[model samples]
Target: MICESFPVGPFQCNCVILACEETRTAVVFDPGDEADEILGSLARHQLKAVFLFHTHAHLDHIGATDLVRTKTGAAAGLHEEDMPLCENLHIQASLFGLPTPPTPPIDRFLKHGDSFSFGKEKVEVIHTPGHTPGSVSFHVPAFGLLTGDTLFAGSVGRTDLWGGSHPTLINSIQKRLLSFPDETAVLPGHGPRTTIGRERRSNPFLV
Candidate 1:
């Protein structure tokens, strides 16, 4: 598997592109903004995007969802619990005084335990809510964990937004994320990468 992550948009949301070297099929996580950049990455990698997966429906994480989907013909997937927020993109943008972009229709409803493959690599969905009711983390056993706004380098996600819950976020981190192998790489949505053990031992919120 080939992985690339970069910050995009005004908020600097981390967008990730994962591709299978053998088949050149890719899965884009959080196009966020900068459709041209995202598309260019795909072209540079010589990979075809087959799926666009969102960790949640937050404005920063989904700003260019429709644009990317339209450009690559990739199917957009998101947890069913976040549908309401996904549908209210305009309101979400309004809250931040940003212009509203067209909301993309969900091509697939993601759920806990759901698994999908791109070439020889597989991605498993772990429904880790709290930052948002439908927040999720993608686990690629051989690669790493994509903890979108869930667990960061020395902190955890903020649960002050719509459908966020502090207790639930903590529970998800402890029960769902911490259970992974200590060496598992944690690729969060907004900051530097860290391992499960590193977070367990030093993350201010988890420790």
Candidate 2:
């Protein structure tokens, strides 16, 4: 398994590409922006996209989703509860003062425990809502976890915007995310990667 991460778009949302070195099959998690760079990188690695998944539908996390799917013929997936946010891309873009881009409808709606296999690698969907009613995280036992805008390195997602709620986000963290192993590598949406144990001990929100 091979994984790569790079920040994209104006908000610098982290876009991750995970692939199986043997099968060359891959998945793109949060193609926030810069379609050209994302596509170019995929080409460089000679990886074929199997699924395009998002942790949530915040504008910064989905700016390049439509473009990536169209170019790669990849099936797009999101948590069912976030369909509204996916459909409201334009509104979010406007609110965030970002340039409006064409957004695509989600082709697959994932439920908690639903699993996806791309090449030899596998990912399990964890419905860790609270950042938004539909926020989710992707967990790959062999690699790491892609946490979107939910749980961060030392901080957690703010629940003051949109469907966000402070209590809910905190609950999600304590119940859903904190259960993961201490060694699980956490790749977040907007910052450097860290481990579950690190955040558990130091995060103000968790402490």
Candidate 3:
């Protein structure tokens, strides 16, 4: 398994690229922006993206979904609960004073406990709401977890946005995130990476 993550878009959302070295097959997670750059990275890695996944439909997270899909011929997926948010991409962007980008049609709907594989690597999808009703985290047990906006390095995601709930976000963290091994690495949607144990023991929001 090969994994790389970088920030993109005006909001600097983290876009992750995970590939199976053996098969050269990959999945792009949270393609927030910079479709050309993302494609370039994929090309450099000799990867053929099979799927483009969004942890939620937030504009900053799915900004380049259509462009990427159109270029890579990859299927796009998002949680069904975030469909409304996905459809309201333009509105969300406008709220942030950014130009609206086209929202791509979702090719598949992801749910809790769902899993997918590329060559020898497998990823598990865990539904974790509260940052947004459809926010999810992807766990690749051997590598790390791709936490959309649910859990940050030393803080949790903000709940003041549409469909966000503070209590629910906390619950999602305790139940979904804390359940993992303490040493498990966390690749959040934005900011630097951290370990589950670090956040569990010291994250002010969690502690």
Per-residue lDDT tens digits of candidate 3, residues 74-164?
9998999999999998899888898888879899999999999877788899999999999999998668999989999999999999999
Reference-based lDDT, each prediction: 0.94, 0.89, 0.92
Count of backbone clashes for each model? 0, 0, 0
lDDT of 3 at 120: 78
lDDT of 3: 0.92
lDDT order of candidates, best first?
1, 3, 2
Model 3 residue 180 CA deviation in Å: 0.5
lDDT accuracy of residue 119 in candidate 2: 84
Order of models, best TM-score first: 1, 3, 2
Question: Per-residue lDDT tens digits of candidate 2, residues 127-198?
Answer: 888899999998998987888878998898988888887888888778878899999999999899999899
Better of 2 and 3 by lDDT: 3
Of the candidates numbered 1 and 2, which has the greater lDDT value?
1
**Model 1: per-residue Cα lDDT over 1-207, one tens digit each:** 788899999989999999999999999998899999999999999999999999999989988999999999999999999999999999999988999989998999999999999999999999999999999999987789999998899998999888999999999999999999899999999989999999999988987
**Model 1: colliding residue pairs:** none
Q: After superposition, how far is residue 151 of candidate 1 from its true place, in Å?
A: 0.7
For all predicted structures, in order, the TM-scores are 0.98, 0.97, 0.98
Q: Tell me the spans in candidate 2 whose CA falls farther than 4 Å from its real position.
A: none
